[model samples]
Target: MSGKLYLKDKLVDEELDLSMMQLTEIPVKEIEQLGSKVLKLNLSHNLLTCVPANLPLLTQLTSIDLSKNQIVELPENFGQLTKLKSLDLYSNQISKLPVSFAQLKSLKFLDLKENPLVPELAKAAGPCITANDCAKGFF
Candidate 1:
């Protein structure tokens, strides 16, 4: 079955929560239907292997949660989410990030703990530090 989408604490049209679904992929078209109204998305605790490259099309998004999934790599143009702020990718399988990751200038929070990251990249990432410093010098 397709994953279910819901609004924030209250059922609204501005955010989407698709967490705890057994989804292997995100429903891009379904999410696109929200248009510019969608500003946050939660896709945690699923079976996703990869994030769709078209995800950046939802430019209005400022937060996203992809933790506890099976994602191994992000889209090459992942940096297109220029307006993004908080991102959670903890407990996933991500090893390497795209060079474009440096483009997330607005990002303020990121969670990459528990992933078997590459030594070089992991060392570059340094000790887990929350807040806006999470993606510092990530290029």
Candidate 2:
């Protein structure tokens, strides 16, 4: 759809796959409150502009897919996802990352392909072109 949908208070514990749904936008706030115990989320192929503020509240979230969106910046609190292990942000509009991102010690796999690279942040992340670079300690 061209518009956004707000489906709150829905208990979706099993894998909820919405791949290739042609969804343009999603209201993150309403979705966060619904899946309090959700461990994985897939929002690929949407027309998002920014990372959702309430994302970190999904304490159980270990994997998230935000590929092919228009996200330009990530929230500083994005690092607060201590339980997060895998994050997919491929093909977005992110130009720079918050320094706080390094705090995600639990992060094991991150994808940042097709996004602009901030040299300074890349330097801070230690010569890593992708999260794989950081994960491999290439810096």
Candidate 3:
């Protein structure tokens, strides 16, 4: 929580890498202050148990990495990230996705490896490893 204002260049254009920050929740205000300067967010390797409720507020996000965390659920309206093209949710505790997930029409790359997906999801997301294969289940 003290690192709310922490800034890391992420070595990528318009990206903010807050990975391994040991944060339980995202600093929505601080990230918002950067405005559209942040197009990608990396919150991997943290203690997060759930996605930030207001994360959909960052509508400019093109990619998000929430891997290696304790995420159990996504915001019901996560599809609000219509610009999001890549999503990495590997090694998490997620079991089912929200109905709104089908609305992510721009998503091209997805990684849901190491998750305990439900039977339907597992069938739809067959062999999710490569970018192309990972994106098969979104809709």
Say which candidate scores most in TM-score: 3
lDDT of 3 by residue, 1-139 (tens): 3644556444368989989978898787888888898998999999999987789889999999999998988989998999999899999988888888888899888887888988888677677667766656555
If both were scored by TM-score, which would come out higher, candidate 1 or candidate 2?
1
lDDT of 2 at 60: 71
* Best-performing candidate as measured by lDDT: 3
**What are the per-residue Cα lDDT tens digits for candidate 2 across 1-139?**
2445534323366434555666655555656656555677788887778876676766677888888888898887887787888888888888787767777777887777777767765454453466656579632
Model 1 scores what on Cα lDDT?
0.82
Residue lDDT tens for model 1, 25-70: 9887877875777788889999999999998878778999999999
TM-score of 3: 0.89
How are the candidates ranked when ordered by lDDT, highest leading? 3, 1, 2
Give me the runs in candidate 1 sitting further than 4 Å from their true place.
1-13, 129-139
Off by over 4 Å in 3: 1-4, 8-12, 135-139
The lDDT per prediction is: 0.82, 0.69, 0.84
Enumerate residue pairs that collide in model 1.
none
Q: List residue ranges in candidate 2 displaced over 4 A.
A: 1-13, 123-134
Model 2, residue 2: displacement in angstroms? 13
